[model samples]
Every structure is written in C-alpha cells, then in structure tokens.
Target: MGEPFYITTAISYPNGKPHIGHAYEAIAADVIARFQRAMGRDVRFQTGTDEHGLKMMQKARDLGITPKQLCDGMSSYFIAMCDNLDVSYDVFIRTTEERHHTASQELWRRLEANGDLYLDRYEGWYSVRDEAFYDESELVAGEGGDKLSPQGTPVEWTVEESWFFRLSKYAEPLLKLYAEQPDFIQPDGRRNEVLRFVEGGLRDLSVSRTSFDWGVKVPGSDGHVMYVWVDALTNYITGLGFPDETGDFANYWPANIHLIGKDIVRFHTVYWPAILMSAGLALPRQVFGHGFLLNRGQKESKSLGNVTDPLELAERFGVDPLRYFLMREVAFGQDGSYSPEAIVTRCNAELANSYGNLVQRVLSMIFKNMDGTLETFSSAEADDVLLATVFAACRDELPREFAAMNFSGGIDAWMRGVFACNAYVDEQAPWTLRKTDPDRMRAVLLTLFMAIRDLTIAIAPVVPTSASKVLDQLGIPADERSYAALTGADWYMARVATGEKLGAPVPAFPRLELPEDAA
Candidate 1:
C-alpha cells in the first residue's frame, strides 16, 4: 500500500468514433486500476487521445476543419465512451496539449544530450494508418503486387531529413533486459515475438518527421514535428508531470504496467524502452500486449461496416454486463469474439441466474423469514462446510489471480464461489428449514447472505454497477465497501448488522431477452 501503482492504456488515435475495441482496452485497464485502489494503493491510471498523427491530419482535411477542432470533437467521443463504460482513469491526456509539447521536446533534448539522437536523411516505407515506419522486408506483396505493411496497412515510399534515435545500439541491452526481468514483456507469445524481432536485426529509428507540421515541434528544427509515436508515447510520462523531475514523477514514474493491444507490442516493448534508456530514465516495469476484440469472428473494420460503437452497446444492454462480457469472454491475452448473443447468454446465465439470483434469493429469505434481520451463527466455523470451502477459495484465489493479470481467471474464481452459494441455497432449502426449525433457519440464511456479500465484493471491479447494486440491496454501509475495509477488519468486516433489517429487495441484474431480430 505504501508503494505507488501506475497503469495506462495506449492512447486512442482520435480520428474517428471509438468502437468496442477501444472500450475493451479501457475496461481491462480500469478493472485492474480499480482493484489496486481497492487494495489501498496510490494508483494513477491514464488514457487519452493520440491526436498528432498523419491519419488525424488527413481525417481533418476530409472533414474540412482544423485538425485541433477535429481532434477536440473526436476526443470527446472517446472520453464519453470511457465514462459510459465506467472506466476509472484519473488522468486523460491529449498529445496536442501544451504540457505534452514541453514533455516531448524535453524528452528529445535528453536523448540528444545522451548522444542517442542525430540528424539523418531517412528513406523508408511508412504506413499512415499505423503511424510507423516499416522495413522493406516487413512489407508484404499483395496479389496485385501492391506493397502493404505487415499488418496489412498500405505503405508509401518516403524520403526526408529526420532526427534518428540510435536504437541499433540498444538491441543487446534489450536482450539483456528481457533475460534479467523475464517479464518486461508479457503473454509469453508476445515476449518471444519481440525477442525474435530484435534478434533478427535492429535498426536506427526516425524520431522526428520533417514532412508533417500538425504535431509537437522538434526543438531547434524548423518545419519539423516530432514523430507521432515519440510524441504519443511520451504522454505516459507527461501525465505524471515529467521534465519537472519531481512530485508525481518522483513517485509514479517508471509505470508499473503499460496495457496495450498486441499490434503495437513492438512499439511499447522495444522502441519505448530504448527511448527511456537513452533519456537515463527507468523503463516501465511491464508491457502487456492484450488481444483485440473481434466482431462476427472477424476484425472490426470500417469497410466491413461492422464496427460496433461502445456507447450504443452500453445503451442497449447496460454497462456492467458489457464490461463483464469483455473480460469473461476473452482470455486476457488472446483474441475473442463479441456478439449480442454471447453477451445475452453470459448475462442471463452467470449474472442473472448465478450471482444475481443468489443475492436476491438470499436476501429475500432473510427478509421474509427473519423480518429483514440477520444473526451470525455461534460456531467457530460455518455449519455448511462446502459453502465455507468455496468462500475460502474465493477469498484466497481471487486476489492471486488479479495480481497475475489473469482477469478471466479472477472472474472464474469469483464465479466459482457464486455458484457454490446458489448450490448451498438449493441444497439446504432454507425455505423448508424456516417452518421446521426457525432458529436454525436464521443461521443458515445469514450464512448465505454473508457469502453473497463477500462474493459480490470480490467481483466489484469487473461488474461495478451490478456489484454496487447488490451491496445496496444488502444494505452494506458505504465506508465498508472497499476491499480493504471488508477484508482488513476483524472477522472479515461483516456488513449486515446483527438484527438490522435490510432494505426492500431489488433485482441487481435483470434477466435479458433476445432481440426480436435474433429470434
């Protein structure tokens, strides 16, 4: 708790409306950030728009407006998406911000002072879609013999005077870093890909582009803008008040984690670290490249007309279910498909039936049988041994999974307890016990309520809205809602007071119905 935890999502390229892909990244990062904060850490979570790029410049021209105006409108859409998804980011940065300009120039000066940067005539294939330069070999020939970047973006041959970073000299250093840290990059597959890339051969990187003027200006260089990647990546440090070299920088610099999409792993794991080393700064602790969200089993693309708007999805099916499906359907580091059907199936079965049903049913029993009051069993242990075991498993395993970045694993572990709670309710049949042995029924219903309370708290990060609703239905006090307040206090911080009547029962996750079109 004493140490600071800094986490960030790669800034979105605000050239268009944000899609479900953007929401996926933001929600994943938010889940972890919320969990760390709930654990009592000083957490700084940042996400923003990468407004300085050739794509944005071209998009602005197409719309017949200044790039800043275009970015201003588009960035608002992204911010709205984050808000709609309940993403808990503390800082939102725009690369066009004045602070970013100073930070980019300062970072450049540091690289220059370290002798890692120099002016050079650059010739390469560049992808405006990617805002990255590619080597000749990295371009693939299409059936029509047109060259495309490795990720299938169209490339153009370009030549200009540019400032270059001596990235070639850092290949060996990066290898040593991978060897020593072993976790500098993540998902094992992505780390190996980066290793193979730097092993294949490292080359000098162009740091400033003379051909573009809609970006951060290159210090002391006329008519030049710093490369979009360089400016965009520095937002991580700029958000921490870098160049000032004190305060947030002194505490939160050297980000604990950079959560990014896999397509940009090379930039974060290789190029970013080399830039940091050149500046005589600490590299981020981890770079995790998570997978993309697919639509109808294919990558979402504008041409395909299948790009799903995140806000629209939230409007149709509420926020917590969408957030839950984003994590629950996908393994943290692998591609996963999204559809209305999948979302409905998961929500109806897991949220509505298992977890949601458990909360409403347990509380309903306590209210109907004990007049909304509860009393703890006097035993040193729970009467239902199996339910106790499941609670213990969730109590011990959910935190461990979150720490390892296995978000799906954490959800699974929490759901395991949820299912167990439901099973205990059915098998014990507290309703029948109420008539036969009313006092024993009180103990059983209270135990079930406690399990519901703890399990809901365990999953609050992933499905925040529903979890909060569940706690409110249980009348959990506000101060005891955080993970620390619950798990930190004696007796695991009981929330349902002894003989205190809970409020009227309300459905947490209402059952969803299939769209008429789906039928």
Candidate 2:
C-alpha cells in the first residue's frame, strides 16, 4: 500500500439551494477518493457547507429568518444533495459547528501570536454579494456608472473596523512554495495565473467582518467575526481534529488536494495557503481548480435565473450517467457547456452501445452456451496482448490523466478497455466457435469474461451504478470488486455464484428530451 491520501471539496456556501456545479465538484472529489481507496490507501474525503458570511446574513434577512434557521434549511439541502450523489465523504463538516469555530479561533490566535494579524480600518470596494473586497484595478464600470466586482456582482464602498491577515508578508514565500511544488495548483494555466497575480503583489486581506454577525467571532474580538473564507477553510483541519494535534490532524493536516471551482481558486490556492503559512502550518499538497459547468452556453447563476438543479437532471437521466457524462464531457480544468443532446449522444455511443453492449453480449453467451459457468482457458496470444493493454492503461496512462485531473481523458481510456474486449470477441468469433469448436468457444468466452472484470474495476469510480450492474451479472460480490484485486491475476478462480439472477439491465442513460424553450 502507498502512503495515506486525503482530499476535500470546497465546502459549498449554503446561501441558496444546490446546483449542478456544486454536484460536479462533489462528484469529482468523490471519484478521486474512491479511486485512492481502491488502491489500498487510507483515504480521508471531507466535504461540507460554508454556513457563515454576508451572503448568508443577507439570505436570512430576505427569508425573514435567523441565520441559524437559514443555515439549518439550506445546509440540509446541500447535505441531502451529497447523499443523493453518493459522495463517500469521511466527514461532512459545517463551518457553523463548534469544533470548526474553535479551530478557526485557534488559527487566528496562532497568526496573531506570530504578529501576522492586525487591527485595521478597511475602506474599499466591497461586494456584500461576494463577501469579498476588490482592488481598484479589479473593479469594472457597471450600469449607471456603478462599480462591479470581478465576478460581475455590483460592489459598494464600505468602511468598517476589521481584523486583517498580513497576506502581503507571505507573498514571496508563497511564490517560493509554488516554485518548489509546481503541481501544488492544478492545470499549468491556473497555476500560472495565480503566480502572475502574486508576482504583481499581495494585499493584506481582511480576515474579519464587523458589519455581519453571522460568523465565527475572532478570539477576544467581540465585534469582529472571522471572515467566511477564513472560517470555512479551517474546516479542512477541524474535520481532522486540529489543535488537539494528536488524532487525524497530525496524520492528515496537510491534505493531499483541495478540489475547488475555478471561481474560488484564489481562496483555496492563494489565500488559504498564505493563512496556513502565517499560522506556521503546512499547506495542502495541492489545490485543484476545476472548471465550471455552464447551462446553455452561459454560466449557471441564481441571479441569472439559469441555475441547473442537479436533482432534476438526475431525475431525467440516471445518476451514474449524469455523473459519468459531466466528468467525461469536460477536460476537468476548462469550462464546459452542458447540453442534453451531447449527453444523450455520449450515452448512446459510449454507455449503451459500447460498454453496455459488451457486458450484455458476453453474459448472454455465457448463460446460453456455458450454462452460466465459464470454463478455464489458457491465455492465448491475442488474449495476452489485450490483458497487457488493459493493465498498462490502468497503471500507467490512467494515473497520468488522473494526476492532471483530466477526468474526461481518464474515461476515454477506460472506454478503450471496453473497445478492446469487443474487438477480441470479434476476432475470436466465439459465436462461430460454439458450433465448430467447443474448446475454442470456451476459451473465447473466458477471455471476454476476464476483460469484463478488468473493465468493471477500471470504470467503477466513474459509473459505479452501471459497473455494479455489470459485476452483478457476472455474479461477483461487491466486496470482491476492487481494482487492486482485479489486476494481473488468474481470473479463472473467480466464479459466478450458482442461481444468481442478473438484474434487469435497462438503458443506463435514456435519451434526454429538451423542452422547446431550451431547444
């Protein structure tokens, strides 16, 4: 087994309901965690909601409810979405939790002790909608000559007393850290952008807010509350038992990766790491900024009234197919548009036609000719080559693609296994051999069976429901369906349990029909 691995998705800000973009990040992190677990490594997968900030306060006011009441309702939706999406998180943390508040306070105290925090009056362009401050250069002219944030949210000038973190002091060290660990931030393009921003200069970031009381209070600072990002980021450590320093925190303080959306890459890659450095803590191993999911060629935003509900999509299409299509549709680090047509095409071509057909045909033939029991066969030259290709694809090419977070490429590689198995079936002509040569027929079916087993293991993380279906047809137990247990082994010993009935194999992804307006 390799060293322990840890990963986390950016805790979703529970200002509103969940959307497809939120589901995408959670699914991506879940896939990585599942893959690492299958590799026989101890894996910690954390996810949760960011329940504090100006946005939450505004939302509470809008709803005519307390902040806690707002969070209680909104956070439950986010949590329910994670459960619906099968996010196998080891811990689901909420920034509003007492433990998280404690951790954030301890981090603030440490930074203060190191002279990295100071009391300051902040007067600048602040976006209550974003809970973020923007530099003069970043503010753009909006309608009626008003200023807008970089995210295009309207900004207003605000003056308040706040606690500030000396982010500018660690700019040089941050650049140095990036220089030392080039892979610390995902996709070369994102890393380059962050580096350019830091190289230009850093500003001391406001770490607390006095205007909003719906947040964790800074230690000994009654009026000031810890900033949302500051409070939320601490959940990564708090979930691991930070400040105690004797439990999971000591083991997984520096998470292997913090998976976040491109919009907040700065918070995770730049601000979060600087905060950790200021507090004399190790930074996370990598911060991956995954691209956004666009709806009908436009970014999904609630204000735009174009937010795509993930549950609605899953209800229309199966969950695994939606999960697979999202990851396979985009290159992972570049924004990609979501279209029903594209999804249906992928499902028909890849899922139904390729992977599904391969499994159905293989099992149907085995059930008919072999009486649902496959006979052992020696590995032929062609079988050896196909198996070797599958092994190389998983061990070498798959890792390289996953390391870069190219989930689409990884899915394509997995499909190659399905393609190879189909090709092997064609070349062997098992249908013809069943009548002409019984021995050769068994060999062909056995080879295809092994290939199916290997393919099931490889694609399990992406399309787990369908993979489970395939494995069930083959009568393999769920516990025995691990990747580590599948590779480079004599699969003849693997038996299909007698009297086991194959589950009904319907189309995993039905064709999506777009409404006329969407069309």
Candidate 3:
C-alpha cells in the first residue's frame, strides 16, 4: 500500500438526470484518481447523488411520487452513468442512507458541543434551485425587476425558525488559513474570489430548516431538518465512516481534494472548511472548483433546449474516444466546449490516425517480419535517442504536469512522445531495412516496441480500455502496466525469455464519423 490519496466529486443533486456537466466532473476526478494510483498511491474515490433538499421535495410532489421513490429512481441513472463511462468510484453514497443520517447528526452534535450552534430566526433570500441562502447584497436584479441569486436562479423570501452556525466567528481563522496555505483553494482565480468574499465579511449560517422534513433530522429538535448543504457536505465524511474517528476516518479523514463545480465554490471552499473547523477536524488539503462544459459555446439549459445527456453522447461516440477528447480538448480549471464535429476531428486525428495507427503498424510489422518473436538486439545511436526522448516525456514531463492538475498540458506532453515515435518510424524506414539490412531492421523494430510500451502505460489512466487492448497485443502483463513499470529494466528481457509471440494487432481506436443529426 502507498500513502493515502482521497478525492471526491460534489455529489450530484438528484433533482434532474445526469448531464454532460456531471459527467465532466466525474471523469476529471476519475482521471486524477487513476493517475495517483499509477504514481504509487493508495487512492479512494467517491461520488454519488445528493438526495435530500427542498427542491427534491417539490419535484417529488409534482411527479406524485414519494421523495424516496423519486430519489431511488433518479440516483440509479447517475450510478449507471458512472458504470457506463467507466468511472472507478469506490463509494456511491446517498444522503437518504441511514449511515449518512447518522453521520450528519453526529456532526451536528459535535458543532453543538463546540457551542457553534444556536437557535435563531432566518428571514432572507433563499434559492430553491441552488439550495442556498443569499444575502441582500448578493442578489442581482433579473429581467423585469425580479430578484435572483447571484447564479441567476430566482430567489424567494423565506421566514422560519432555524439553528445557525457561528460562521462569523471563524472568518478571521479562515482568512489566516488561506494565508498560511496558499494552495488551500486552487487556480488563483477561485482563491482570489473567495478571499474577496471573506474580506467583505461573514454572517452566521443557517444550518437547520423548519420548512421541510426531507433532510436529516436535527438531533433532539423535533420539527427541523438540517440545511441541505450541511447534509450534502457531510457526505464526504459519511463515506469515510466519520464520527467513529477510527479506521478509514483516522487514515483518510482530511481528503486530498474536493473536486467541485465553480458555481458552488463557496459551499465547498468557504462553508465546508468552516464546518470542519467548528467540528474540530482537520480541513481538506485542497478544494478545486472546476469550470463548466458548454454545448458548442453556450451553457446548456432547459430553456435553451441545448442540454446534452452524457450517456447518449457516450453511446454516439466510443467511451475511450469521448474520454480522450475531453481531457485533451479542455484546459483544466477553465471552460471548454464540445460538439460532434470537434469530437470526431480530435479523436480521429490524434487517437485513430496518430497514436493508434502507430501501435497497429508497429505490431503488425513485428508479427509479419520477425515471426512475432521478440529478442535482444543491438541498438544504434538513433535507437538510443528515440528511447531517451520517449522516456523523458513519460517519466518526467507528463507526471510533473499531471501532479499539478494541468491535465491538458500533460496530454500535450504525451502527444509529443507519440509524435516522436511516428517520426522515428519515418526516419528509420524499417520496411526498407527489412530488404537491405535485416539485423538493423530487427533492432529498429525492437526499439519501437519498447517506446510503444512506455506510451501505452503513460496514457492508460485517460483511455484505459484502448490502452489495455494495446498492452494485450504487446504481451505486457496486467501487473506490469503501471507507471512504476516504466523504470524497471528486467521486464522486457524476462518477457523475451518467455518466448511469447505477438498476436495480430487490431485497430484499438477506429476513426469515428459525425452523426447526421448533429451535422
């Protein structure tokens, strides 16, 4: 086992089906988790649906279904999305689960014990769509003089008896935390935004709601349920078995990162850390608020009729190609757009034509010319230079960029390695060597064989299925496919000793055509 690396996605609110935005966040988090494991870390990845909130209750009423029934049916769609898209999440928690309720109440009890909770009356702007309370200063005037939350969701004035957390008391402490740990909130823009918000001032946060009972009950308070954010945020610790304060809670308590959308940055970075501090727990190492995925150039919405169902997109395009296009096309921590033409052009040129063709041509030639027998061969200066270039990209550049969460940049480095191998194939002209100098040809082919292995392993985290197919043809064992395997010296010779013959190669990433409707 390696050092623990725990990461989570903002649990999806189940008022609607899974969208492209949800899929984008889950895929990014999964890539990070896989990348960490490849770097020799024990990783825990969690994602699920946030099932309790006032919006859910109203939606259930409109459907004439019980809230649990609505949640049960809706959350399954999210689970299926994860399964279909190959999101390797370890836990899929729902706030309706009994364990989650227990964890939420336990957190409340801890806050109460710390004197952070107090009875109060809340009369302010509440956004049902966002499940958030907003201050008068934060509301914006919409078309026709309607008051809206900063997110542009309609706001309603609500009056209720509530319990508030003394968030004001921790404003200075949170500021000090940001100062001491400059990387506590990521991407400088988000961190600076939070800094400005906190510098403006803080107010006591309403932690319990008296208007609805669709949430975790307030401990010993007969008629109130917790604010949805409190219950939803607690899902992070709930998955780790908190309150017991032992086992996983003891080991992975303070998560490495909470990957969330920019729309809810305040909830995760500001409110979450404050809540953790009030409960006397260590804060998460970082909160990263990532940008949205747009359809073409505009944000998707029901009114726009541009909402994309991610599963449908996955079905239209192969999963690996879709995954590749996302990490390759999008600049991490910033907004990116995708359309059918973009997906086809990017995947076809890069995955199908460039890297995939390199794998197919190299392996097919080895099978046809060398009788599929891999053997030790003498290398020339060109062979050494090619290997060194590929090695630097895989072992040094890609890992460095990925560790900093610059995913597009890391893939760019990996593509450079791929391009180098293709260029080597052209320069060596191994086919000509087969007729003129068979021994030199064998050496050239073997050098390419080694370079292909490194490229495959470096990229497996992003496109796992296609990489596995390539590795299978290369006779690389499952256990030896991690990044750690790239540096080991004896694997190739050991494989040659096995006398395993390479099989006929298949196209791992066949070129895709654009759908007619999308065209």
Candidate 4:
C-alpha cells in the first residue's frame, strides 16, 4: 500500500445479466482496493463493460437493436450489480466510449509504426463463445468428434483478411518479462500454464477483423475493426484517459494488477503484454487469473440454466452477509463451490449464530446490567491467554493475508479472533461475575468492547455496512475506523473513550429461513 496501487477486473461483456462469477471478481478487487485505501494507499480501481464484441453485435441483432442501443441497455445491469455489491470502482469504462476508441486507435498506430502490424489473409478455428482463436493442436475433441477449444467451447473454421500483430517476435521478450518479474502471472498454476503455452510456439496474432462492425475501428482501415481482445484490453488505459497520460493515466498507468477471470488468462498474460511491448508501454505488474465460481459443482452459465442472479442472493441475505459468504466459503484463486447449502451454512452458523450472537449477547449484557457505559478494565485474569492470543494473532495475521489477496485467509484470520472472543465470553462468564465481582465484570465487558472494536476495523473491507454499525455502537468516531485507531496504548483498557456510552445494539445477522421477503 506504499506506492500508488491500480487494479482492474476484466470488463464484463454486457450481453446478459451478470452472474455470481462476475460479482466474485468485482468483490475481490473491491476488497483489495478498499484494503489498500484503509492502508492509506493512493488506489485507483477500474471495472466496466467490453461492449464492442461480436457477441454483443449478435445479441443486438437478435433484439433488432443497434449495438450501441444494446450496450446502453445491458451495461446498466452490470453497473447495477456493482452498486448492489458496494464495489468502489473509481471508474466504470465502456469500450464503446470515444476515449476508448482514441486509446485503441493510438495503440494500433504504435503497433503499426513499430512494424508489428501486417495485413494478411487469416484462416483458423475460432470460438465465438470464447471470443478467441485456437490452433488445431489446441483443440479438444468432443463426443461427436467436433473440434473444440481447450476449454471445450465449440470452434468453427473461419477465413478473413485481417491485420496481424507480430506476437511471435515478442515471445522471448514476454517470457523474459515473466522470468524477470516472477509474479507477472499469478497463482503459480496460471503462470506455469501461460509459460507452457508461450514456450510451445509463438504465432503472430490476428489483431483486426473484417467480419463485424461492432468493435473499435483500426486506424486508417475503414473496412476493419480491431479484434475484440485488442479493443477491450485497452479499456484499462482508456479508463485513465489514455494517449494523454497527463493526470489520471500518468499517476496510475502500468496498473499494479489486472484481476481477470481464469478463462481469459491467455489474453491478459500473453497477447496483452505482447501488444504493450510493441507499443513500448510498460506491462501491468501482475495478471491474476482467479478461478471461476461453481454453482452446484458446475460452472454458472446460461446454457446450464444455473447462472445465479447476484441481486437475488443479496436480497435473500443482506448484502454484507452475501459478501462475507463469498469471500469466506471460496478460497481466493481456486475454484470453490457455491450452493444454497453452503450459503445458508455460512450465513446461519458463522454470521448469525456465531459472530452476530457474540456481539448482541455482549452488548445486551452491558446495556441491561451496566447502563451501556464502558467501565475501567482490569487485566487481572491472566487466564485470558486465549483472548490475549487472539488479539496478538489478528494483529499479526489479518493485514498479511489481506495484502496477499487471500480474502478467505484474511477472514479466517479474523474469525480466529471472533471464535476466541466467543470462547472467552463463555469461559469468563461475565454475567456470573456481574453480581459477585462487579469490577471483574466491568473489566470483562471492557475487554469484549475492545475486542469488538478491533475486529470491526479489521473486517470493514469485507462487511462495511455492518462494521460501520458495530463501530458506531462501540462509540468509535467516524475518522478512527482505520487500523491506525486500533494501534498504540495497551488496547486491553483503551483510554481513547473510557466511560463512553455505547449506542443501542441491534442484531447484525439474523438467522435465515426462506420467507417471501427473501424472494
């Protein structure tokens, strides 16, 4: 979080409603951006739609609308999903925007001027579903012996005269970039896969297509539109008002990370860097291809009819609970199953029963017994080794996991703190101590208050709205929500707000059983 950190999610191709997979990437990127901001970093987060694609054109034609009209109608759905998730993207760029067209044309000119573009008759197997081309060897055979892309997306033979980018010439350079910056592609598996693909052989890439008019037009080529990848990938720079890198672009260019889906790893890790190299632009620091979200052990897709509407899930359980389950149930960077069973389990057990119950019980006891005013803490009980260990462990582990983009690990680390607090409350029996040793009871409540305070700050990125409520009940000032507030002075008996009256506490996560409201 020291340097300016810029990150992006692959722009959604706005042909339909965004599924859980789309929300997964957005939430992950948002967590990183929010965490970095909390760490006091200058962070720029970008996400949006890749509206200029063959798919969008087809969808538009099927609807009897122009592609622009289709993009306008569909992009709002993606924007709505981001808003519903509380994604704090600084910019939502659409490739159809004029700025993107300018940036794309500039990139094309740079590649052409640098001798990377050559017009040639192209013939190959292409996957419309994937928006990518595949070589004969890269194709998989189906049960019917039909050719398919490696991901099993069906491929069709296509021939067109197109502009080619000299990707073959940059193979060594791209590999060297990977070797020099070992983290160029992340999650080791993706890095290795990209390396193997490049090592197999480098082929010049088709950079422009004449088949459709729905994409950014190649500079000086009236009949050709830039290939979707070429046009779409530039949105990263275009979002910053690229080709003009004077302000936003100058400050945040060469993004810290491009957080893309695993399916698009090759385009981001391979072709993207090659194109940037031809333009003499610095590569993005990292391209992390996180795994897909599987619903019922199968990928969420329209064809499967299992594509989950993110808004539906959010409506069933409050937005924060939905956010928590996704980051908690799924290990970041690996395929994780999402099922109603898993969601309800995490929502009821972790959020409602465990974490929520702890907060409500502790605050209710203080309110009913002590008039909700915090009293002086006495750390006389050395038996609170468990609670002490929790504070130390969370202070050590939470930031480390968060910085590494392991949302699950970060939340797990915080849950260690949560579970310990719950265990401490039971072991100390604050209610029993309230009558016998009132001083001891005060100390115990104070300890619980401090523990909740620290945890609320730690969890703000994941469950912001609930954490804000928790912080308010703890009498935390608006400005002190950052981790800095948790540091300094023995946190066991915080002098920051001694004898402060806490606001009335409400249940954070209520146990869920499907009702009409959930619909």
Q: Which numbered prediction scores highest in TM-score against the true structure?
A: 3
lDDT of 3 by residue, 134-208 (tens): 999999999989999999999999999999999999899999999999999998899999999999999999989
TM-score of 3: 0.99
TM-score of every prediction relative to native: 0.97, 0.94, 0.99, 0.96
lDDT string for model 4 (1-519, tens) is 356889999999988888898998999899889888877789999999999878888998999999999999989999999999999999999888898999999999999999999999999999887899889999999999998899998989989999999999988998898899998899999999999999998999987889888888888888899999999999999998889968988888889999999989999999999999889888899999999899878987677778789998888777898889888988889998877667887889888888889899988888888888865555865436655766665566888898888888888888888898898888789989988998888788777777777788888889888888887787777877776666645543454447566666888878877554322
lDDT against the true structure, per candidate, is: 0.86, 0.82, 0.94, 0.86
The best-first sequence of candidates by lDDT reads 3, 1, 4, 2
In candidate 1, stretches whose alpha carbon ends up further than 4 angstroms from where it belongs are 379-387, 485-499
Clashes per model (N, Cα, C within 3 A) = 0, 0, 0, 0
> Model 2 over residues 394-441: C-alpha lDDT tens digits?
666665676667888987888787788888888889999899998888
Q: Pick the candidate with the highest lDDT.
A: 3
Query: Residue 103 error for model 4, in Å?
Result: 0.7
lDDT of 4: 0.86
Residue 315's lDDT within candidate 3 is: 92
Pitting candidate 2 against candidate 4, the one with the higher lDDT is: 4
Task: Write down the RMSD of all candidates, one decimal each.
Answer: 1.7, 2.3, 0.7, 2.1
Model 1 shows how many backbone clashes? Answer: 0
Q: Which stretches of candidate 3 lie over 4 Å from their true place?
A: none
Model 3: lDDT to the true structure: 0.94
